[model samples]
Target: MSAMEGDSFTLRTGLPEIQRDDEIEWRFGSSRTRLTRIAVGNITTCNDETFRDRLQLERQTGDLTVTNITNEHTGVYQLSIIIRNKKSTKRFAVTVYAPVPIPVIFSDTSQCALSAERSSRIFLCSVVNVSHVTLSWYKGNSLLSSISVSDLSISLSLPLEVEYQEKNTYSCVVNNPVSTQTRHLDIDQLCQIDCDLCFDSPEAVIRLVVSALISVAAVAAVVLLVNDIRRFGRTQTMKR
Candidate 1:
């Protein structure tokens, strides 16, 4: 009467041992990464049912093989072993998460549509598949403030202040447990049209006045020439 048990001498708690040139197949990635290590219990001793002879029980460590892991290889896995006409099995679980991608910020700072008075221009932050992401604004590499987005998406309105608008490099860092992504926003001064100098200056006013005077003089001269020709024709007709 031989009884096989997880403990007492038939199976030991440890990694499987393999001989030279022996094929050891370690399966992983049913739902997660491969196994790094495994723990097993001591062996259990037992007697055969025939009772003709004493069946010596010996626990052996099973051989394990590892392969390179990838993102798609995420899932539960199991380890199986066969010893002396008996089979045993164990189970493990795994989880894989995606890394965060780089964060991009878009701002409306062109001169065509200027920001409203006393209001900041809107800047949008966009990240893909980063649910519940935390967005932190920074000047250079130093952290300024962190804000949590309740939804997957949110827009940040950045007022063009004297200090911040002049900064050379403004950055946004987005992070999660899996990964962190950062992006830099360059704030440049809008190419402006100086209305006081270019449009409403002394030179511009003088040019406008000269153009109006030339137009009036041309019209008056044309009118007087037409009247003089008509009066000369009438006097010649009376003489004839």
Candidate 2:
């Protein structure tokens, strides 16, 4: 059985309730260290301080529960039930894993976009401080690419390329044995970048409007100077 850390897990005895004459014992690990034993309607727990205050036993059901499980709680558990000289043994294999972290999708133009491929952009799906997880890129429901990390607490990145006008859906998913986190691609946001050049930018449009206004002002000034000169010449001729 696989369980997430900080959660509770129960090892069932398969019996609805414990009988008065029945004896139940639960052990842990390869050394067969005793954890709990029920005998003669009495329950007893071990003094293993490594799992201090984290073990619970249901007196009526002969079930053992571990609360707030951590890496130390991951191992094989053994259960023994004795009734009328008949002994039955069961073993449970448990694995505990951390919660999967959310993946972030961002543009990676530092080196990949140096070709000036304005129509297409490079993006990366990344997760930090993660281990034993798989990071993947998916186009809609189809898998595009993936990368995995094991045993090392390192970061992971998966690259993907798409057109600026892409209409299809995409998502980044990171998952472990028992947990998964997904981030949907917002083409208009993370894929959004500066215009191909200044000509298509809002600043460029503003500059064009300013230049037009300046040209009109200069033309008006020239026309006024020409009219003033013509009036002066007429006045001089009339006076003569």
Candidate 3:
């Protein structure tokens, strides 16, 4: 089973009742370190630093509940019972995952303005500081590709191609066993103008303002030159 950090989960021993003189022992981790034992109406708990004060065991049913689980709590847990001089054991595998962060989608349209044969548009989906999660690209309701990572301290990224003149819905999805997040792509809003110039960054806005001013100044200069030429022609005619 899977759990997120700070959550609680139960591992069932599947035993309905404990008979008198029957012994039950709960162990955890890769080495099967003993966590707790109950026998003859007495309970003994291991003072191990990993499970100290964080685990509870049912006396009658032998079920275990772990509270405030952390990444270090991920491992195999075992329940051993002895009845009628016979011993039986069961194991439960637990996986604890960190919370997945929301993914950011970036459009790389630098070549969108080039010739049709040479231009290609790409979208990248990225998430930071997540683990045991998958980042995926979806076209409409179908999945295109996915990338999975188990390291929580690193980032993950997935990419998809956006064909020119291709009309379809796309989205980036980031998910773990406990949670999911999604970001939709607005193709129309992004491709309304030249893809290379579609982004309204501060630098792009400044360049646009400068270009507009230069165009206005050039028109004013042309209008003044035409007026000067006309005035010169009139002065020459009057002198004649």
Which candidate's lDDT is highest? Answer: 2
Model 3 local distance difference test score: 0.82
CA shift of 58, model 2, Å = 1.3
* CA shift of 129, model 2, Å: 2.1
Ranking by TM-score: 2, 3, 1
- Candidate 2 stretches greater than 4 Å from native: 111-113, 193-240
lDDT of model 3 at residue 199?
A: 31
TM-score of 3: 0.75
Residue range with the least summed lDDT across 10 consecutive positions in model 1 = 1-10
Report the C-alpha lDDT of model 3 over 15-82, residue by residue, as the tens digit.
89988789999998878899988899788899999888998989888788999999999999998989
What is each predicted model's overall lDDT from 0 to 1? Answer: 0.46, 0.86, 0.82
The digit string of per-residue lDDT tens for model 1 on 1-240 reads 111111111222255563333221233443323333322334322232221132232223453321233333344445555444355666544333344568776644452234223223344556655554577777777777676654444443332233323545667788754457787765442222211112223554586688889999999999999999999999999999
Q: Which segments of model 1 are wrong by more than 4 Å?
A: 1-72, 78-93, 109-116, 119-122, 131-134, 145-164, 189-240
**Please, what are the lDDT tens digits per residue for candidate 2 over residues 109-164?**
45333544366777788999998899999988999988988888998989888886
Superposed model 3: Cα runs more than 4 Å off:
112-120, 151-153, 164-166, 190-240
